[model samples]
Target: MNRQESEAHVLREATADDVHLMLSWRNQETNRHVSKTSHEITAEEHARWWSAVRDDPSRRVLMYVREDLPCGVVTFFDLRLESPRSGAWGFYLDAEGLDGRGETLPAWLGVMREAVEYAFDGLHLDRLDGEVLGHNTVVRQMNRRFRFVEGTPRQELSDGREITVIPISLARTDRRQR
Candidate 1:
């Protein structure tokens, strides 16, 4: 992938038009496998979830764009926009779409970089946090590359099964030191 093209990415506020696409991505088998909620979400469920959080001040749902092509979704929740601003973030990419175009790796890396920038710079957040399944070592390594420190692992019941969750966090100061 061209360096310029890989870096040509942006994050934009998700709109009503993106609801379907977001739902499709979220429901992808690969995505659902590692998610906190592993079931295929019904249209009604997705609608309710979107409606509840779309305009909520404490949550942000953004569309990830690479070279003008919408390729993923980024979300920030549990946002505390006060003096010690902090939030938890999560994302998922259009794996099938990007893979067809041979842009999967670049898009994946770009989304993370842009999301981190958005969390700290665009949102003026003091800290950022995320949760990754223990078995998802690839993503955990990626998070560490971005200076996110991993916390203790905890077990949570999801879709009738217990899953190990590893909490990771990055502070504004730590990011700046990169």
Candidate 2:
């Protein structure tokens, strides 16, 4: 594949129109399973969430655009612009794009690279934090590749199953060294 096709993901600020699409991706079986809360969300619930965050300065919900298609989403929440200059982040790809396709891994990597740059350089944040389910080894590895240092694991219940959530953090200096 050409370089552009191989690494063409872009992150755009999500708008109100993206609510349904974001919900669809979030509610996918695989996505839900790896999430802290595995239950499916209703339209009403999603609408409420969208409304709450759409105008919030402390949160940013972005969509990953690849070849003009929105293939994933990345979000930064709990932004502290004062003393800490940090935020928590999460991301998920479109389920349809990840069905044994050869593009999934590369697409994910490109999106993550862009997301981290946006977090540190574009947003000028001191640190970014992420929490992944312990069972989601792929994501855990990806975070490491991006220089996120793993922290103590926290136990959480998801769909009645007790799972471990691994916390990871990446500082601005970490990205600078990369």
Candidate 3:
């Protein structure tokens, strides 16, 4: 993959049309715990969320575009100025992987890389928090690759799934050495 093709795996800032797609992915069984909703959300509720994000400075809802197609999604949101330089983040890729043609489906590591960069550089955050199902060893390992440490174990109310909330941080003094 060249620069553009590779970078096509990520995009920041989601539009209105992207919200519907996001909700479907969130309601998927694989993404239930990692999502904000236990059930599917209506357009009205989604609009409220979109409006709040736009009105809030410490929030960003982004779409993960791969090969110029919307496949998965990632977000650097819930920014707290009281504890500036910190935010909550999450991502989801379709389990299906990709479609025919050059467009890839589901989610990929390239988007995760860009999402982390957005958390550190784009959002200028010192710490970003994420949660993974205890069963999701692959994602847990992936978090470690980004220096995310298992912070605290918490129960996911959505599906009664046990999860470990990890912190993938990048402080001012500590940039990149990995």
In terms of lDDT, which candidate is strongest? 1
lDDT of 2 at 32: 94
Tens-place lDDT digits, model 3, residues 3-34? 76667677768887787787776666666644
Question: What TM-score, over all chains together, does every model reach?
Answer: 0.94, 0.91, 0.75
lDDT of 1 by residue, 1-178 (tens): 4567646788899999999999998998888987999999999999999999988999999999988889999999999999899999999988878989999888888888889989988899999999999988888888888889999999999899999999999999999332
Supply the TM-score for candidate 2.
0.91
lDDT (C-alpha, whole model) for all candidates: 0.90, 0.86, 0.66
In model 3, state the lDDT of residue 32: 64
For candidate 3, the per-residue lDDT at 52 reads: 80
Models sorted by TM-score, best on top: 1, 2, 3
Which ten-residue region of model 3 has the weakest summed lDDT?
97-106
Candidate 2 per-residue lDDT, tens place, 61-105, comes to 999988788889998999998766899889998876665566688
**Model 2: residues >4 Å from true position, as ranges?**
1-7, 176-178
Q: How close is candidate 3 to the true structure, as a TM-score?
A: 0.75
